[model samples]
Target chain A: MVDKKQALLLEDFDIEIVSRDLNFYYGDNQALFGISVGMPAKQVTALIGPSGCGKSTFLRTLNRMNDIIPGARVEGQVLISGKDIYQHGTDVVKLRRKVGMVFQKSNPFPKSIFENVAYGPRIHGTRDRQQLAAIVEKSLVRAGLWEEVKDRLNDNALGLSGGQQQRLCIARALAVDPQILLMDEPASALDPKSTARVEDLIGELRELYTIVIVTHNMQQAARVSDFTAFFYEGALVEFNATKLIFTNPKEKQTEDYITGRFG
Target chain B: MSGSFSENLIYGLLRAITYAIVLLVGYILFDIVIKGLPVLNWEFVSGYPHQSGASGGILPAIAGTFYLVLGTISVALPLGVGSAIYLSEYAFQGKFTTIIRMAIITLAGVPSIVYGLFGLGLFVLFFRFGASILSGSLTLACMVLPTIIVASEEALRAVPKGYREASLALGATKWETIRTNVLPYSLSGMITGSILGVGRAAGETAPILLTVAAFFLPKLPNSIFDQVMALPYHLYILATQHPDAEKVRPMQYGTALVLLLLVLGLSLGAIFIRAHYRKKYKW
Candidate 1:
């Protein structure tokens, strides 16, 4: 909700990805309305809202991933590293390279674990076998999945358990070396243990990359994110520091949502 | 549980009839294999067509069938799969595409004889291509095009929505996504359609007879215009024109066995392709 033009490297944190007046529509149905938020670098910004609140839609806008939907369209600027991603001639492939995403359900490609990790690099023209191997190893380690899956990298990713597959999907997204990661309810599909693992992974990732995650769990947003933006019915209800949003929120709706009164 | 003896008898009789039909088909297959087995030989399978009155090879006819099928595939594959992609992935769900899809299914159900007649009009007369292998293959292609298109479209349709979304989300262009992911993943199913098409093209006699108008030319065909000797036509000739010709009988029996083998081989190949992918793609 904050749109004040401040210096990129402010005292709180440097901005990485910024959205200005973003609106989304599916045919005549407006899903998101005038969502302007600045995401800080090397920190997690959680978007917490109730069902059908356009939180997912707003997360999809970061990487222009909504372009895949047949009837969906996004309006306004989504800037990554101060570059307008929606501008004409801005190669979406390159933009997505710099902005990775993970979905709610772990969607590992129907490929071997090695292939799943190497896919992004292959697409970006990395054919050197040793380099791909190194990247895969490093990414799996970064995603906290290397030791568990190291021996079975050639096996199909779908062969892994649900929790492990989610970690592998994270590693896949991380393989591209993106500066921004968009996670749309990434842990919602996992069990409590896997959810805690992903939350821990998020904690570590905030030291290196900007993260925008959409979650229905207010407790999760409070625990993992530095800043929280609460949405309701396609509108930004409140945006503030996560502790402030969860503890002493400005909006009554935010208080009710955090207190489990009317989620 | 039947209320009356008569009703129970009728139920038993109906079930017996179902078993009887299955047994009849099994017996036919048994008869064909038993009768045809003793005659099969390397000389019979690969040798040229002739010997005494009965002993000869059907090499030319076999080659004709092969070339005819290859030509049909060369022409039909791109058109069929492209149309399928357009219909399943690109074309909007509208009355036009729906009507076109319905028409294709209808074409598939039409008898081969009707397709032959239609081919006769289109290839032989309308285009004036004449009774050549090209026209024959074209007729056969049209006859099987519907099967290929429908099966492939179903395969394309069966691909989960997530795959398309994932590819597009990765910022791959639509065509590139389809080309690299969707097409490769459904190739086994597409192969099943194509193999079925080839089977029909290889065996169907009426369509080729009408479109190609097979002439008793002993030489090999060099072009589509050149009249070719397909196995189906040879069998037709051996059975009807020279029924008592003992020499042709062996060749005919040998050809029949080979035709059966061709169909079986195609089916096995399709199954193999599907199995290979099923094992390779678990995710």
Candidate 2:
């Protein structure tokens, strides 16, 4: 693990999101302990850990997605673009619009391909058929799905292949024009080829949006992320450059986890 | 070999039970069709009853039942579906909600005659709607409200949670999420459930007996406040109450057959709606 001093130096970069002594609880059970990290702007930050290690919980806290669960509570500050998102009177809908999320399962609405991409913009009050169609096309193009589904805009989204469906979900998230993207195991449900396609899309997306992804696959983290944070038992074990974390991790636990030892 | 033999034996018994049920239902339907077909002329269906329902057709009864069904649906669908949405989506799940759910299940189990008495006391007497179609429909709506609410809640629950999460994550408000992602997907299910409740309301006799059923009125209702002749009570009177009960046996069978067809038609409509939506949204 990088020492506290070195981790603090990461703030020198143009940070997009930062958590300060963040603690989270589901009812009485603590799920995350004092995690503070800065994610650089326009880069991919991968959160890698075994199942039930609270990496997904931490990702959800940034966008307040966990608020929907009864008795889920959060402490400390989650700052996005230098604004404290967890402050009182914060517009959570606006916060989520700025920080879009793609779940592990591709949950395309029971709508056509065009409608799926158009849903976000329409909800945000993008009327006018031409403008809505334009936004849909742009989002699908950005998600790398336009070429495959352009002709079949009116087809049901659920009829797409697994990989295409996942890409369609990415397009749906992109349609709202969010600055940050949070993906929870976006490719875990896809086959190897589809996973590669999604990984490539993520690499391209990192050029524009700040991305925080939770993954169980170490190889995926190394391949797609610029920075990697390894979480263990609800605590941040290590957060460093992806190369350092994969090739020469400073912490023994992270090194053990990366080398195929006990997670 | 022993496992395979036991499996085959169990399957055989299950199949036998299934066929037995089919045969029992088939026999009852056959009996009704054979006895009623002779009496089901166009005049019997379209002409008003005359001679104390022993000679003329039962048009007024058919019209009354149709009106009762329409009124019951108008009153019950919105209230039951609204209650279901509130319970499943908006209400906080706790002891209070648990009690409410328990009360609904208990109400569903209440006997038809008890509902009849309740309607008599409440809508007919207390509300002063009189023994009219208005009172009968309101009573039938109350009786089927529990069924619609339960079925609608189940349908809403059947929508995948991920859809809500996805919509919310994209900055959609909770109501917006439900309106767009949840309601459209679950609408088929809600309609199916409501139609089942409406079918029950259309066929119920006890609740309407005390509230609106007219003994031998040949004239069609002028308004909801006018008392009307319904099929079930008409059949009941013809079979047991009329002086020439044996003579009106054919009329009783015909009335029973028409009621069966009406309910069957409503169920078939529900199935078609469900199938159409299922094709549109397979997930």
Candidate 3:
């Protein structure tokens, strides 16, 4: 991992989360070296890197999604609300509820649209029909999908278009009332029109949820994110305000990547 | 060109082979239907056998076969489906799982007569369950468990991993996710597997012959411990064991036809259920 002294200044922002010297391995093959970064509260932080650069790996670590994979291991600390999630006896289920995730491909359950949104709440013990309906409506509206689907809430979610399916996944995540939303290339599989709509939705979601997104599209990072972190070879190369990263990058690697010289 | 000519020749050969198989099956079915149709009236199905199964219907055999299939399924379905779930979802993929799989495959290839002898030694003699429906059903269940387990495992594996990950990512426990998401989706497959096993178990003669089949009982079994008249055993007697076997030719044909229909009906039911579930959950 590259040495950086700027981590000392991480406390300057209203930090919503922190990772201190995080290292990860998949069965003795280290996928991430010691990495550290802080994300501000209620802002969009985009992680940009080429494929297999550990950007998606880092995003998954936030919600302990790596725990499900066999032979995977993690070291160092991921702190949320001043608590290390990796600490012994941490409630992983509760942690996931607090840090929701959307995958690269849309994965709506084979359930009705309403059920897809109500799934999180129902699992978390919401039983009243009226209450579930309210949560489903609020989440779909927040995801910018309520108007398109409200008339057919009972329809199977798989029948929706691809863009609508991704948005439904987003709405499903939001229904759990998580404070942080981690999206891994949530728009990568969409057409240009759908990509714009999802990007616009991300811009709107940043006001309420602290969002961390991984994107291969550099312009998408520059468009929706307030802060940008450039990662390469499992290391954070540069992180700064999006405008500064795009216009006047401090690192030559970042400049070259932004200019399409190389990945 | 010559390349297209070779392709056409290969395609024609494949079509001929397919047609050959269909013709063979059609000929067998046509033979059975014609020979058995004369003795297929309701009286032949519901009446008790007379004169050592040389003169009457096979109602007792039909009921006995039904009970045996029911008992075998009840015994096998839970064990098979549970073993499948454990293998697919919980067991680590290593030497232990490999050993388990090898054991199941070996069990599946064991001869039916060997299973019959083993059941006779265990359930009939050691356990002293006697030559009864319970003993026969247990024996048939053991014989078909391997089939059900293999099919159920395939069914469970058909479910995509995305559903599991999606559920777990939402903070559901592994059991909760399996129960609500995985089990519901795979249930139809499991049932289909059980139904296919039922078809096989229902037609098995050796195990039941040793453990439960009676030579000429004309009454329905009054309890699990009672010896029962099964269709295959009855047909075996009518064809070879009766005093005047040639005189009971119609009875033999009818018994064979009924057993064939019962097994075919079960297999068709399994196929129908599998197709319905595939349409319901495309993923």
Candidate 4:
């Protein structure tokens, strides 16, 4: 654990999320240790690591999805847009609405495609059919799925292909009009074609949403992200520009892991 | 000793055992239908009894059975399903929840005659509701409560956890998620369970015998307080307790057939609902 703290020099680009010494635990087992990183606004920051390296755990901390697990606890601060979300009396529902999330496997509700996209607005007290329709359409279009699924909006969302279902989940998260989007291996389960489609969709979504994606594919990290953070054994090993992390030297562990010598 | 020959023998034995059970059921049904069909006329159904259920229709018994089923369901459905939702959605894993689950299982195993005695002591004596529809319905509801809760809870549990997570992640409150997503998918299961409970409630003679059933009141009940003739109790009296039980054999068969049909009808309806839901949500 010596020389473990090597801070990345965050340049003047606006930071959308800041984690100061975040530690997370599930019961007695700790999963993340003193992870500190700044994700710049409107740019995709990819968290890449070997399996069980706490990248997904860190990703879930941003939206507080880890709160669902029993005996799961978090220490330290997670600030989004300058507000400390872990502070007491913070409305978690409001926080989730602001910081939307897409999970590893696509989990569209067993509902119609239109309803899948419109679920968020409907629950937040939007009763008018017209407004819900408009929001659904806008979300689908932003997710790059509207033209493909416009005519069959009433069809069961489970009937969609794997890639479409994943995109539908993204559209659902976007329908809430969140400032930040957290994706946990959003394309890991899809075919290559579907993965390409989702990657392209992520490229478009980055312009409006502050995207933080957790991926297993290093090539995917290089292709889609501006910044990359490498994690190993529940500690953040390196965080820098994707080009520098990929092309130049950093921590011996990161260079070794990324170069396929060992995970 | 050949493998295929032994496999064929096992298959044949299973088929024969299944056919034997089916044949027994068919024989009983055939006997009942043939014996009851001779007297099961419109007049026999609609007309009032002449001399202590010796002749005429079993209208009052039919009406009483209907009332008992209605009252039992009205009392049990909400209580059972509410407890089920609480158990499945809200109750934490602890000693208290375990106690509740154990109590429900124990209640399901209690004998119908014991339920009758309990109803006799509680609703008839302590509460002084006396021998009336209210007492009978309350007793039957208690008897069926465990069934409804178990079935409804199973249905609630069958709803995928992912659905609940998706709803909560979309900023829906826990109650809102349950109301919209959980309840809709589990409704068919709940209804099917309740229907099966209703069937059990209808056929239960011992509970109603002590609580509400009358041996010879061949008329419709005007109020919940009225003691009425129910099909199962009526059939029991005509079969065993009547002064001339040997002469009224046809009426006994008819009553038995009607009760069987009522229970079978409810069970079939539940089957239909289960099938419909299975088609709608394959996941």
Candidate 5:
């Protein structure tokens, strides 16, 4: 069953992450039910659904972020670069380094802006002062926050505006140089202008990295993603090109959700 | 109009009660200051007590109290903070953890005199350390351990979960995330909590009386094992045990005043440090 799904998903593009029949539970309450999907490399994939529909859970399982939650349990395989992440002896720290994440809310550490960006590289063993400085600059530039924050890199990160802080969080994630980025509603808390800026940033980032984003806004999914997966009630109702999912969804539930009929 | 009148009456009653409590505390402080000031010269502060503390300064008692506080801090802060980190960050929430939490809360309410007796049994008699500064400090540390642990755990929990998640998502290990993100932010709170413990340890007399206090040792301790004079015990002796307690009334008030000042100074210093760190880490 997994092999057939893999063949179908691998038909058009190179796959960076694939979860086969993934089931997740928190204690006795199941949150995800046999989810299978593939995210293409160097492309943006958006998971859209209503609140508590397990889009965020699926995103977190890619990097095992849910491991920190008490009683959270996952079954089936999450493959990153064709390696099953749940297998025995897999190093979670190394897995997370390869697949970084951005949370729904901006959560920069209470440190200097420079320190916030430098944190990832420092933890991964980049030690020289000059090397750290260069990494910090490159990450900030890539996140498109360097121009605004270059003069105040030493200021406390909490002092930044909300939108700027979100960008700084992106830069911090980028510093580790992950190949895949998992974002859980990265712009849901932002103003319209900031949201547009983040959407544009996402468009630019897809050229260099595989991005999987979970969002509730269908318009955001349509604007920023190449592929869209519509999740409802912990099940994937449809997965296809973003244009098809929006205009000609195969599943009735997908059409209903996309057309604002009912969640 | 009736509702407004009732509200105003309640508000006035509450304000009056608050002012009454304040006035009571102010009267006690005023009485102490008025009696303590005339005898609080350099001679009284720095000179050795003579004739069973009937006349002279309380330098030895001051030094002993300072040493006791230092020892309590050195012993309690690390143990308490470490336990707090384990409880808040690492420990799995289970029956075991719940029991541990219950034990800590119960320990916090246990009487200090009970701790004094425990110290007498464990450190003084069983360990055979005798009535010395080492025994007294160990006792005080045990007594304040619960307070520091409870406060430090509260501080650790007060930090937003987002910081830990952000650090972990950035590929940092659990300990590394805690070291960089959690501890630095919660440090001011932990220090503030520890200073409260230190204040309690410094002012406590019963624990030291059973474990280390010397009634008339008019000199500083030379070693941890040596008996030392403490402000509370000295004041207790001057107020009640001294043969000429009537003549030493001013000395008693002076010793009480000095001890109060020391505890207040320690708390104020900690408040300043906490404020500085709070400014640095606003989130």
Candidate 6:
């Protein structure tokens, strides 16, 4: 074990969310061990792992979504823009305002397309109807869903096709306008075309928001992300530039994952 | 081969018997409808109790029934739904909470007459409220409380967790997520539950007797605190206790049919709202 302090960087970059020695547990079972990852400002960092490897658990720890689960516990430091999200004075609600998420399933709120997109902005106290409309429009446009559902803004979101619904969810997350966006396989439930569109949208969003994505598809990570982190059964195996991790990896586990071995 | 054929025949006979029992309730409904139709005229609905306690309309009793049912609903719905929200969304499920929930479900299964007796002991006796509409409504509300709570909890639980996730992910608090998304999304189901609850309460005869029984010798209630003639209590009395009841038996059947129609209407209304929203939600 080398005291390679240089393995982790914390000097100059704007850290949107910095997790150090983060661990999680569900009752007696441990989901994640001590994991450290630096999520920089306005970049897409993908967390890729196989089934039951704790990628989702790690993503959930960021905003304390796991707190909603009974007997779920965590020990660690997860800082969103400098303040630790788990600290006593930290308002989880306010913290969530600074960090948004999109889930794997396209869960539009069974409301209208317009209302679904506008839900977040409303919660944040944006009462100006016209501005809300603009935010909705801009968000839908950003998620690449505006062109399809623009005419049917009042139509229930549940009525939309699978692809359209996922984009609507993205639009909803963007409507909150958080500094960081967490997407757990946002495109996995989508078709290939929709996946490509979401990938493109992720690339576009990277210019403005810090994004942490969890995906099984390695090609997706290579295509749209700046950084990629690999996890295997609750440990961070590697974290590096997308190109470096995929083309010239360090650890044998990372190599195995990239080479399509048992994840 | 002979034994297998007999076994099949016996199984078929059992199925037919079970189905016949299920369909038997329809025959009773037909009996009520056939006997009640002629006497269910506007004059009978609009009139008051006549001389010798025969031939008059049950307008005041009918009116009192609506007033009581509505008041009970108004009393029970909010508290029931509020409790359900707290239990389902806020309460951490554990052994103690499970015990509490078990007690509640058990409370629901307790007989209506026992609820009436309990109401008599509580609302009427302990509270010293007397046999007024307020007391009756309160008793009826207790009778229906479990129904509303179970229905409401089921409805709340049926709301997809993703909706809450979407709301919370966007920075809304748990209460806000419930208020904005889960509540509205489950409104249709909740209403269906409420309708069923209302129907149960409206049709319930046993508890109302001990808590709010009326001899109906005549008059209308002026307030919640006033003693009013509830239709079920009125029907029960006219059917069983009326001294010259055979002469007015047709009116009792008519009242029964009307009660049936009212419940059917409420159930249909619930189904309508549910289907309307479901259609709107369906892709």
State the DockQ of every prediction.
0.39, 0.81, 0.62, 0.65, 0.82, 0.70
- Highest DockQ model number: 5
**Model 3, stretches more than 4 Å misplaced?**
A1-12, B1-13
Using DockQ, rank the candidates from best to worst: 5, 2, 6, 4, 3, 1
lDDT of 3 by residue, A1-263 (tens): 12232343344568888999999999988888888988888989999988888999999999999988888899999999889999999998999999999988898988889998999899999999999999999999999999999999999999999999999999999999999999999999999999999999999999999999999999999999988899989988888777778987889999999999988
Highest TM-score model number: 5
TM-scores of all predicted structures: 0.90, 0.95, 0.94, 0.94, 0.97, 0.94
Per model, the share of native interface contacts recovered reads 0.25, 0.88, 0.48, 0.58, 0.77, 0.77
lDDT tens readout by residue for model 4, B24-104? 999999999999989999988888887889899999998899899999999999999999999988888678999999999
Please provide, for model 6 over B190-210, each residue's C-alpha lDDT reduced to its tens digit, 9 standing for 90 to 100. 778987888878888887787
Question: How far in Å is the alpha carbon of A247 misplaced in model 1?
Answer: 0.2
Candidate 1 CAPRI level = acceptable
Q: In candidate 5, residue A74 scores what lDDT?
A: 95
Runs in model 4 with CA error above 4 Å? A1-9, B2-10, B278-282
Candidate 1 on B176-242: residue-level lDDT in tens? 7788668877888897888888787789898888777453555567877877778787778877787
TM-score of chain B of each: 0.88, 0.95, 0.94, 0.94, 0.97, 0.92
2 versus 4: better TM-score goes to: 2
Interface RMSD of each: 2.0, 0.7, 1.1, 1.3, 0.7, 1.7
TM-score of 2: 0.95
CA lDDT of each prediction against the hidden true structure: 0.82, 0.94, 0.90, 0.91, 0.92, 0.85
Worst lDDT run of 10 residues, candidate 6 chain A, spans A1-10
Predictions ranked by lDDT, top down? Answer: 2, 5, 4, 3, 6, 1
Candidate 2, backbone clash total = 2
